[model samples]
Target: MKKRFDIYKEHYKALISLGLPIVIGQIGVIVLGFADTLMIGHHSTAELGAASFVNNVFTLAIIFSTGFSYGLTPIVGAMYGTKLYTFAGQALRNSLVANTLVALLLTVCMGILYWNIENLGQPEELLPLIKPYYLVLLASLVFVMLFNGFKQFTDGITDTKTAMWILLNGNVMNIIGNYILIYGKFGFPELGLLGAGISTLFSRVAMVVVFVIIFLRSIRFRRYKVGFFRLGLSRTVFGRLNGLGWPVAFQMGMETASFSLSAIMIGWLGTIALASHQVMLAISQLTFMMYYGMGAAVAVRVSNFSGQHDTLNVRRSAFAGFHLMVALGVVLSSIVFLLRDYLGGWFTESPEVATTVTSLIFPFLVYQFGDGLQIAFANALRGISDVKLMMLIAFIAYFVISLPTGYFCGFIMDWGVQGVWMAFPFGLTSAGLMLFARFNYMTKNR
Candidate 1:
C-alpha cells in the first residue's frame, strides 16, 4: 500500500512537470480565441455570430489535424524513452507530410462549404455575413496544420514549453492585429468581420514560420538534429504515421463535429439561442482546453512508461490524471453553477440569452465527471497506441448517441438549447465508462 501511494506521488509530480507547460500553452491559444470573440462581439452581434460560424467551420479542420499530428507524441515518447533521437526526428518529418496532406483535403472541403454557406439553413441575413468571412479563415487551414505539426513534434519530445512561447507570441500578435484590422486603427483599413479572419490567418502563418526557424536554427532544438529537412519520405514511415494518425483524427473530428453541428441544431432555435450557444461554447472550451492540457500530459506519461515496459506505472499515471481531472471538473462546474448568470451578462447584454444560458448550467455540471473520465481513458488508450479502437468508441458515443439525443431533447421535446447542453452528460459519460472499461481489460490481460 505504501509503495502504491509512493507511485502515485511520483506520477503526480510527473503530471505537473508535463501538465503545467501544456496548460499555459493551451491558455495562450484559448486567450487568442477569446480576444477574437470579444473584439468581434463589441463590433456587432452579426459580426460576432459570423465570427462564430467561421471559427466553427475552421475548427473542424484544426481539431482533426491536431489529432492527426498527435500520432507523434506516442512515437516520439517511445523514441525519447529509448534515447533514439534520430528516430524521433524521422518520425517528426513523416508527421509533417501526413498532416499537410490532410490540411489540403480539409481546405478543399471548406471551399465547398464556403460556396454553400447559404444552404446551411441559417437565417437569410446571416448567410451573406457568414460566407465571405468563412473563406478568409479557410485560407489559413494550411498554416494551422503546419503549426499543429510543429507543436506535436515538440510535445512528443517533452519540450512542450517551447510551443507555449510560440503560441504566446502569436496570440499577442493576433490581439494587436485584431485591434488594427477590426477597428482600422492607425494606417490599417477597417475590415470588421473580415479583419478578424485575416488577423487569425496572419498570426497562424507567423507562428508556423517561427516554429520552423526555431526547430531548424535555434540552439535549443539544434541538438535534436534528426534530419530536419534532409530526410526522404519512406513508404514505411508514411504507413506507420497513418496507422497512428488517421483513427485519432477521425475520432476527434467526429466529436468536434458533434459540437460544431450542434450549432446547426441551435440555429433551429433562432438567433438568440445560437448566440447563447456560441457564448457557452467559447466559455466551455476554456474548461475543455484545460482538460485537454492534462489529458495530453497523461498520454505523454503513459506512453513514456509503456516504452519502458512499465505497465504498472502506465496505469498509475492514467489514474492520477483521472483523479486530478475529476477534482478540477467538480471545482470548475461549481464555479460555473454559481456564476452562470454573471458570466452571460459579462459576455453579452441580452437578458433572455442570459436566462437561457443559466438554465444549461446543471447539465454542464452533470457532465463534468464524464468529460473527465473520457478524456482520461481516451488519452490513456492513445498513449498505449490503441487509437483505432478508441476512435470506434468515440463514434458510437458522440455521433450515434449524443447528436441525436441532443436533437431530440432540444427540438422535438421543445427544450431548446438547454436540451442540447443536456446531451453532453449522456455522451461524455457513455464514452468515459466504455473507455475506462477497455483500458482496464487491456492492461489486466496484457
Candidate 2:
C-alpha cells in the first residue's frame, strides 16, 4: 500500500510540475475573456450579445486551427524524448508552414461567414458592433496560429514557462488596452466593441513577435534554432503533419460547432439569451481551459513515454492528469454554483441576463466530469497519434447526438436555452467514455 501511494504521489507531482505553468497561462486567457465580456457588457448588453455571436462563430475556426497546431506537439515531444533535437526543430518548422496554411483557410471560412452574417438570425441592432469586431478577430488568426506553433514547440520540449510568461504578459497588455480603447480612458478613442477587438489583435501580434525574438535570442532555444535554420521543409513532414492535423482539427471543429451552432440557435431566441450565453461561456472557459491545460501535460508526458516505449508511464500519466482535472472540476463547479447569482451580475446589469446565466449553471456543472474525461483521454490518444478514430467519435458525439438533442430540447420541446445547454452533458459524457475506452484498449494491448 505504501508503494502504491508513492507511485500515485509521483504521478501527481509529475503532472502538476508540467501542468501548472500551462494552467497559469490558460487562466490568463480566461481572465482576458472575462475582461472583454465585462467591459462590453457594461457598455451595452447589445454589444455583449453581438460579441457572443461573433466570438462563437470565430471560436470554431480558432479551435480548429489550434488543434491543427497540436499535431506538432506529440511529434516534437517524441523527438525530444529521443534526443533528436534537429528532427524536432525540423518538425516545428514544418508545423509553422502547416499552421500558416490553416490560418489562411480559417480566414477564408470566416470571410464567408462574415458575408452571410446578416442572415444568421442575429439581432439587427448589433450588426455594426459584430462586423468590425469579427473583422479584427479574423485578421488576427494568422498571428494566433504563429504563437501556437511556438507555444507547442516549447511545450513539447518541457519548457512551458516561456509561453506562460508571454501569455500572461500579453493578457495584461490586452486588459490595459481594453480599458484605454474600450472606454477612451487614456486619450484613446472610445471604440467600444471594436476597441476590445483591436486590443485582442494587438496582443496577439505582440505575442507572436515576442515568441520569435525569444526563440532567436534566448540561449535556451539556441540548439533548436541552429537546426531550425539549417533544415528545409520536407514533403514527408508536411504529409505527416497534415495526416495528424486534419483529423484532430475536424474533431475539435465538430465539438466547437456544437456550441457555436447552439449560439446561433440561441441568437434566434433573442438578444437577452445571446447575452446570457456569452456570460456563461466566459465563466465556463475557466473550467475548460484548466482541464485543457492539464490535458496538454498528459499529452506531452504520454508522448515522451511512448517515445521511450514506456507504456506503463504513458497510461499512468494520462490517468493522473484526469484525476487533477476532476479535482479542478469539483472546485470550479462549486464556486460557480455557489456564486451563480453574483457571477452573472459581474458581467451585465440585466436581471434577465443574470437569471439566464444562473439557469445555465446546472448544465455547466453536469458536463464537468464528461468534459474532463474527454479532454484527458483525447490528449492521450493524440500522444499515441491515434487521431483518425477521434474524428469519427467527435462526429457521433457532437453532431449526431448533441446537436440533435439540443435542437429537440430547445425548439421541439420548448425548453429554450437551458435545454440546449442540457444536451452538452450527454454528448460530452459519451465522447469521454468512448475515448477512455479507446485509450485503455490501446495502452493495455501495447
Candidate 3:
C-alpha cells in the first residue's frame, strides 16, 4: 500500500507541475470570456443574447481548429521524449500548415453560417449585433489557429509556462480593451458587442505575433528553432497530420455542436433564456477549462511515456490527471451551487435570467463527473494516437443520444431551457464511461 501510495504521489506531483500553468492559462481565457459576457450583458440583455448566439457558433469552429492543432502535441511529445528535436520541429511546421488550412476551411464555413444567420430563428433585433461580432471572430480564426500550433508545440515540449504567460497577458489586454470599448472609457468609442469582438480579435492576433517572435528569438527554443528553419514541409508530414487531425477535429466539433445547436433551441425560448444560457455557460467554463488543463497535462505525460513504451506510467499519469479533475469538479461545483443565486446577477440585471440560471445549476452539477471523465480519457486516447474512435463515440454521445433527448425534454415535454441542460449529463457521462473503458482495455491488452 505504501509503495502504491508513493507511486500515486509521484504521478500527482508530476501532473500538477505540468498542469498548474495550463490551468492558470485556461482560467485567464475563462476570465476573458466572462469579461466579454458581463460587459455585453450589462450593455444590454439583447446584446448579451446576441453575443451568446454568435460566440457559440464561433466556439465550435475554434474548438475544431484547436483539435486539429492537438494532433501535433502527441506527435511532438513522443518525438521530444526520444530527443528527436528536429523531427518534432518538423512536425510543428507541418502542423502549422494543416492548422492554417483548417482555419481557412472554418472561415468559409463561418461565412456560410453568417450569410444564413437570419434563418436560424434568433430574435431579429439580435442580428445586427450578431453579424459584426460573427465577422470579427471569423477574421480572428486564422490567428487563433496559428497560436494553437505554437501552443501545442510548446506544450509537447513540456514548456507550458510560455503559453501560459502569453495567454494571461493576452487575456489582460482583452479585458482592458473590453472596458475601454464597451463603455467608451479612456477616450475609446463605445462599440458595445462589437467592441468585445474587436478586443478579442486584437488579443488573438497579438498572441500569435508574440508566439512567433518568441519561437524565433528565445534562447529556450534555440534548438527547436534550428530545426524549424532547416526542416521543410513535406507531403508525407502533411498527410500524417491530416490523418490524425481530422478525426480529433470532427469529434470535438461534434461535441461543441451539441451545445451550439442547443443555443438555437434556447433562442427559441426567447432572449432572456439565451442570455441566461450564456451566463451559465461562462460559469461552466470555470470547471471545463480546469479539467481540460489537467487533461492536457495527462496527454503530454502519457504521450511521453508511450514514446518510452512505458504503458504502466502512461496509465498512472492519465488516472492521476483524472483524480485532480474530480477534486476540482467537486470544489467548482460546490462554489457554483452555493452562489447560484448571485451568479446570474454578476452578468445581467434580469431577474428572469437569474432565475433561469439558478434552475440550470443542478444539471451543471450532474454533468461534472461526466465532463471530468471524458476529458481525462479523451486526452489519454489522444496521447496514444487512438483518435479515430473518438469521432464515432462523440457522434453517438452528442448527436444520437444527447441532442435528441434534449429536443424531447425541452420541446415535447415542455421542460424548456432546464430540460435542455439535462441532456449534458447523459451525453458527457456516456462518452466518459466509454472512453475510460476503451483506454483501460487498450492499455491492458498492450
Candidate 4:
C-alpha cells in the first residue's frame, strides 16, 4: 500500500495542475448560473421557479451533448501523446462531425419538447414565462455543442487554459447580458425572463465563436491545422469515435437524466419542493464540476501513460486523482454541512425554501465521495479509451438503478424531495465501484 501510494504521488501533482484550472472554469459557469438565479429570484419567485423548470428540461440535452463530445478527449490525448499531431487533428474533425450530428438530433428533440412542456402539469402561471424561455434556450444547444467539442479537443491535448479563459469570458458576458436583458436596461425591452433567456443564448453563441477564432488565430493550433473545412467524414474514424463516444455519452446522459428526471418528481411534491430542488441542483453542480475538473486531468495523464504503454503509470494516475478528490469531497462536504443553515438564506429570501434546502444537505454530502470516485475512474477509463464497458455499467447504475430508486422513494415511499436525493448515493457508489474495478481489470490485463 505504501509503495502504491508513493507511485501515485507524482501523478497527483499532474492531476492537480490540470484539474485546478478546470475547477476554476467550472466555478465560473456556476457563478453565471448563480447570477441568473439570484437576479431573477429577486424579481419574482414565479419567474425564478420558471427558470428552474425550463433549465431542468434543458439539462438533459445539455448533459447528453456534453457527454457525447467527451468522446473526443481520449482520442486526441492519445494521438497528441504519441506525437501524431495530424491524427489528433483528424480525430478532432471526426469529433466535430459526431458532435454536430448529436446537436442536430437534440435540436429536433428539444423542438418537440418545447411544444409539449405546457402539458407537463406545471403551474399555469409559470407556463407563459417558460414557453419563450425554453425556445431561446433551445437555440443555444448547438453553440453549446460546438464549444464542448473545442473544449474536449483542447483538454485532450493538455491545454485546458484556453477553455478556462473562454468560460470565464462567457460567464462575464452572460452576467452582463442577464443584467441588461433581465432589467431591461439602456432602453432595451424589459422582457423579464425572456430577456434572461436571450442573454444566455447570446453568451453561449459568443463562447463558441470566440473558441473558433482562438483556434484559428492561435499559433499553437495552427501547427496542427488540418483544413478545418476540408476534412470530410471518414467512415473508419467515425466508427472508432462512435464506438468510444456513444457509451460514454450514454453513461453521463443516464446519470444526468437521473437528477433531471427527479426534478420532475420534485415538481409533483409542490412548487416549494420544486423550487428547493432547483437550489439544491445548483449547489450540487458546484461539487460535480469541481470533481470533473480533477477527473479530466486524470484522464489526460492516463492517456499520456497509455500512449507510452505504461500501464503502471496509468493506474497510478487514476488512483492519484481519486485520492485528491476524496480530500476535496471531505472538505466540501464539511463546508456544506456547516453552512447548510446560512447557505440557503444567502441565495434567496424565502424561509420555507431555505428550510427545505437545508433538509437535503446530508443527502448531498453523502453522495460527494461516490461522485468523486466515479468521476475519477470513469475518466480513467476514458484515458485508456476503454469506454464501452464503462457506458454499460453507467446505464445500470444511473438509469436502471438510480432513476427508478428516486422515483420509488419520492412517490411510492412518500419521502418527498429528501427521498428523491437518497437514490443518488446508491447509484453513484455503485458506479464508482464498478468503474474502479473495470479500471483495475484493464490495467492488470495490460
TM-score of each: 0.96, 0.99, 0.99, 0.96
Cα lDDT of candidate 4 equals: 0.86
- Could you tell me how far off, in angstroms, the CA of residue 166 lies in candidate 4 after the best superposition? 0.7
Clashes found in each candidate (C-alpha, N, C closer than 3 A): 0, 0, 0, 0
Clashes of 3: 0
lDDT of 4 at 397: 94
- The sequence of per-residue lDDT tens digits that candidate 3 reaches over residues 271-375 is 998999999899999999999899999999999999999999999998888989999999999999899889998999899998899999999999999999999
Following a full C-alpha superposition, what root-mean-square deviation does model 1 have from the true structure? 1.6
Residue 324 accuracy (lDDT) in model 1: 82
Instruction: Please list the C-alpha lDDT of all candidates, in the order they appear.
Output: 0.82, 0.93, 0.92, 0.86
Write down the lDDT that model 2 would get: 0.93
How far is each candidate from the true structure, as Cα RMSD in Å?
Answer: 1.6, 0.9, 0.9, 1.6
lDDT (tens digit, per residue) of candidate 4 on 203-267: 88999899888888899987567634455667877887788878888888888888888887777
Candidate 3, residue 434: the lDDT equals 89
Off by over 4 Å in 4: 1-5, 227-232
Count of clashing pairs, candidate 1:
0
lDDT of 2 by residue, 308-413 (tens): 9999999988888898899999998998888977988999999999999989999999999999999999999999888999999999999999999999999999
The deviation in Å at residue 308 for candidate 1 is 1.7
Q: Model 4, clash count? A: 0
Model 3: which residue pairs collide? none
